[model samples]
Every structure is written in structure tokens, then in C-alpha cells.
Target: MTYQRLAYDDAATPEQMHADCRVVTALLRPAPSIRFEDYPREVVKPTLEISEAAARLATALHLHLD
Candidate 1:
């Protein structure tokens, strides 16, 4: 999975801050013999609409980055 965060103005609203946010997920069928990186992957946006909620949640929580 990958996240692309866009630069925003300091005064940007929550909606605007997440307007261009995108979450990319690379999916592959499970297989024992195949290497994870070698498998064919389908790239997609799994939660394109969840960014605003995520941002709000993050802002509310006190994350211990320990």
C-alpha cells in the first residue's frame, strides 16, 4: 500500500486538504511458490473516499510514535 500526500496551504479546510489524497493498494493472488514482489499485481484505490475521515481521526488522536 502507498499514500500520496499533497501539499496544502496552511489555511486549507479539511475537505480541501484531502481533496487530492489517494491510497493505492497493490493486490496479488496468494501463492506459495511465487515471490511477493514477482507476482502480478492489480493496482487500485481501495479507499479513495476515506481520506477526509482519516485526516480528522488522525487530528483527534494523540498518536504515540514510539
Candidate 2:
């Protein structure tokens, strides 16, 4: 959960983006009691991936949870 910026290049292809999104979501979605800060620095890319997945999920579900 540490606030490290995602390091992947902005020009990453759609496939890479999708894979990253899945990895991040998987990393974040477990252990409901775990805070974001409990995650390690190496998890930043996955964190960004999770963020993107969350945004997409919200949009797809027509949710305004953000």
C-alpha cells in the first residue's frame, strides 16, 4: 500500500496493460483486513494495475463508487 508510482512505460501495449491489471487486482483483492500500506514496494505496478481495473469495473458496472 505504499504510495509508489507505477514504473511501466506509458507506451505499453494493450496486452501488457491487461496483464498488469489482472496482477494488480489479484494482489489487492485478498485479505480484506490488509491495508494498502502493508503491501511491498515491488507491488506498485500491480497497484496501478488494480487501480485501472477498479476504474474499469466501476464503469462497466455503471457504478459511481469513486
Candidate 3:
């Protein structure tokens, strides 16, 4: 993330100030623009299938069973 210094003129209006504040907020911590359709497909499982399979095999062998 890059930090930018904002400058406002003395004649800045309420609307301009509000816009500048929004810009600053975005620069400091941008809001997520993800759509609903994309979020459901996100990977929720913490471990991959390969890791789970290896873990199961290790458990069956009683070698460092989790």
C-alpha cells in the first residue's frame, strides 16, 4: 500500500472535504469490492485435499497421528 499526502485549498467545500476523506480512507484501508457471486466459491477448507489424504495415511500407520 502506498501513502499519499492530500492537499486541500482554502476554498474547499463540504462536499470536497467529504470526498477527500473518502479518498484518504481508501488509501489507508481500501474497502473490498467483491461481488456476492464470487464469495461463495472462496475456499473455506483450511487444508488441501492432498494434505488431508497424507494426514489420514499417517493416522492409519499410527505414525504421528493427529
- The sequence of per-residue lDDT tens digits that candidate 2 reaches over residues 1-66 is 688777885688999999999999888855565766866556444333347778889989998753
Error of 2 at 47 (Å): 41
Candidate with maximal lDDT = 3
Candidate 1 C-alpha error for residue 35, in Å: 1.4
For model 3, how does the per-residue alpha-carbon lDDT over 8-66 read when each residue is reduced to its tens digit?
A: 64578999999999998888966686888757766676864458778888888887843
Candidate 1 local lDDT, 1-66, one digit each (tens): 998776974576877656645322234445576666876797886754556667677667954222
- Model 3 bad stretches (over 4 Å): 1-9, 29-66
Candidate 2: residue 66 Cα off by (Å)? 46
* Selected candidate, larger TM-score, 1 vs 3: 3
Clashing pairs counted in every model: 0, 3, 0
Clashing pairs in 3: none
- State which candidate, 2 or 3, has the greater TM-score: 2
Provide TM-scores for the models.
0.19, 0.30, 0.29
Instruction: Give the distance in Å from residue 51's predicted Cα in candidate 3 to where it truly belongs.
Output: 51
* Each prediction's whole-model lDDT (CA): 0.60, 0.75, 0.78
List the candidate numbers ranked by TM-score, top first. 2, 3, 1
